[model samples]
Target: MSKSRIFLFLMLCFIGGVALRSLVFIGSFYLWFLFGVLTIAVFSFSRNRTALLYAALIAVTIAGALWYGRFVPEHLALERFVGQEAAREGSIVKDPEFKNTTQRLVVSFPEAPSERVLVVARRYPEFGYGDIVRVSGTLEKPEPFDGFNYSAYLAKDSVYFTVSFANVALVKEGSGFARGLFALKRKFEENINAALSSPQSAFANGVLLGDTSGISKELNDAFIATGMSHITALSGYNITVMLIFTHLLLAQLLLPRTVVFWASVGIVAAFVVMTGASPSVVRAALMGLALLLARHLGREGSVLHILVFAACAMIVVNPRILAFDVGFQLSFLAVLGLAYIAPWLEAKLKRIPEAFKLKESFVATVSAQAAVLPLLLYQFHQVSLIAPLTNVLVLPLMPFVMLFGFAVGALGFVSYHAALAVAYPLWLALSYQLGVIHYFSQFSYAQIAF
Candidate 1:
């Protein structure tokens, strides 16, 4: 690629990403701003026809996609039923019944009087994945909380209502697409859960498999206090872990390149299923796939390019995702921070020990924090002042914890005693790390309110 083409590509990618994220906070004007930037760049760099053409194509595509997304029917309508009663029949699209006292269900209606509605049901019947049920209840829109906006949350998932069900009855069973996806998600959860046990393990499973059912509020608070909460969610860490593990596994096998490629693809597929295939997980999986493919093709992969393609594909299919998706924004911003800012900082920190060489890891953590800080502050109104230090100390141990935990879990199935042998060491290491986090968190100034 020509230098000008590369520059234009970078510009388009940057602007497009910012635009998509801005949709959640500032709305469509971000899309307009992106267009304006592209228009100016195209004119300013008119000397390079190829560069200009590429920039224009990207600008138009993004702008068009945003425009089209606005008109698509909302997934669930909460407005009409506020303080009103409605009896609706829907199938639970997700695993309904879980170990948690509270559960989330994505219900789909056979035929809604209006568009389908997403309900956050509370204190209802025991339901599992693929359960078809009719709910008679009142639906209402969720109001915004403190600094966080609820409408965007609903919009991202295309959910429009929260329902308090007076009664839910099991109807016909779910089939085809719903059943298949649910079963796959359940199996993945089972594997991860069976592999690890404990509050920390529960948190890891959430981070790796999107199963937060087992995590308690106290553990969640501990994570937040230590700034390690991201480790409990499906984000870049899980994707990178999956990539490293897959590369290692594939390398050990003497398969042909084509066969290896397919095998790698299969691993990602399995990982996606194992992780509940949340929007963020799916996004990371796509990016991981792109990185793998770029390596296969011998192209110098740009994180920006991979991110843009993934965002475009996701938005095209579900435009509402841009508006109501916290995971989408967090995933995009965290990766963007690593891509754009982490390298510059790493270059500056080159004199550090090779093991700690990339103070860029710290920079990556800080950059991701910066990108999401506003949202975090807006939502929680408190910041962990010691997050940087805590992350630096704790992050190094994550891969070990995940690897050992995964191995222990996998082996436990064959020999319980063997798994315990592995778990003992892993648990000791985790305990020490947890102690460090707790110790630091107790410092007088560990956290500061915004």
Candidate 2:
């Protein structure tokens, strides 16, 4: 109990249990009260005031998380929609996700909305963040599909109901920082489109901004067949690579390492915002920042503590994620694997080729696959057989593609000629990438579906 990590481990177990209990509506005020008393009575026998303080804060957080998940207003439930036809007025609270066939937006009531609803509409007359609108349609709850709990999946984001394409009337446009963030994202996407074409622009957008909606099913399926889809989603691995590239790029500009380090954190923060701030990216960014802080303090041994602390904080912030969000699970496990297992794998593979960092890239792909394979199989039901080969071929070029793509997109804001010039080399890299994916996808052995 004297160990600093003892409290941390206990907190993790407590939070995990509480979040699990929340899923089935198992939490009540009585459970919270009894748990509080038991915790206090146990701590009463100890003299560790610091531990007491930590435990108290943790207890409160778990209590809140339990309450939020299990006890909300009745209107927030899916039962609120008594019939199929209904009309509701709310504001678009999240950025709309535009795909080839549909546009999905999350709308919430203007007056103290306790929950958000997913609005699926046609891919026309687009809506951005923070637009007041009147929606008319039949409300339907997502159903389980292919053994997947689609309802629980949407519940993780507090989305309880969905409305298909209906008449959507805009009441007003958005303002403030949320609006500005989406606006900037739209501009950046336009720039990428201006510089590249079809699958090239699609690949470059995915590399630079995690914009995969533009990618055709053929190209996307190709990446999936090759086990390269993770790169396009901008998962934790991609975010980690982006952060490291930003740090190196800043350092090369003659900035002090400390300044460059913090700036990189800021840049990653901005990137997360631009990419819709999924739990995986946010978790990776926070953990990366925590490590940066530990290094800045000149004590690397504290990294483990910082990692645990950051995970706990994120879990407490969104307790539902612990149980429902696959992104959170994959993100944390991926980093955990890299931190604890990649070194051993890297050493074992050192006898392998180092050309274009092929050995390291292959090992990284293997280590991450080892860590997340079980979850991926359960969730996605497909495993890529050619993942190692494809990773070795493509990973070494990732940093460069992302850098040049960002440059070309940014330069478009200032100079079109410069953007076009940069696009040529960017095009070459993307063409090679597209070629590799297309070639691998043709092999029936590339992936196995369960």
Q: Using TM-score as the measure, which candidate wins? A: 2
Model 1: which ten-residue window has the lowest total lDDT?
A: 355-364
User: Which one is best on lDDT?
Assistant: 2
Q: What TM-score would each prediction reach against the true structure?
A: 0.75, 0.85
**C-alpha lDDT score of every prediction, in listed order:** 0.62, 0.72
Candidate 1 regions with alpha-carbon error over 4 angstroms: 1-62, 65-79, 97-99, 122-125, 175-181, 184-197, 245-266, 295-298, 337-380, 408-422
Return model 2's CA RMSD, one decimal: 3.8
As a TM-score, model 1 comes out at 0.75
Clashing residue pair totals per candidate (backbone < 3 A): 5, 0
Can you write out model 1's per-residue Cα lDDT over 55-151, one digit (the tens) per residue? 8668755665465546445354445557888787777765553546555666767655334455555544666666777777787776787756776
Candidate 2's C-alpha runs over 4 A off are 1-3, 22-25, 33-78, 248-256, 273-283, 345-370
Write one digit per residue (lDDT tens) for candidate 2, span 203-271. 887766666888888888898899887777655655554555456557668988788877887777766
Model 1's alpha-carbon lDDT is 0.62
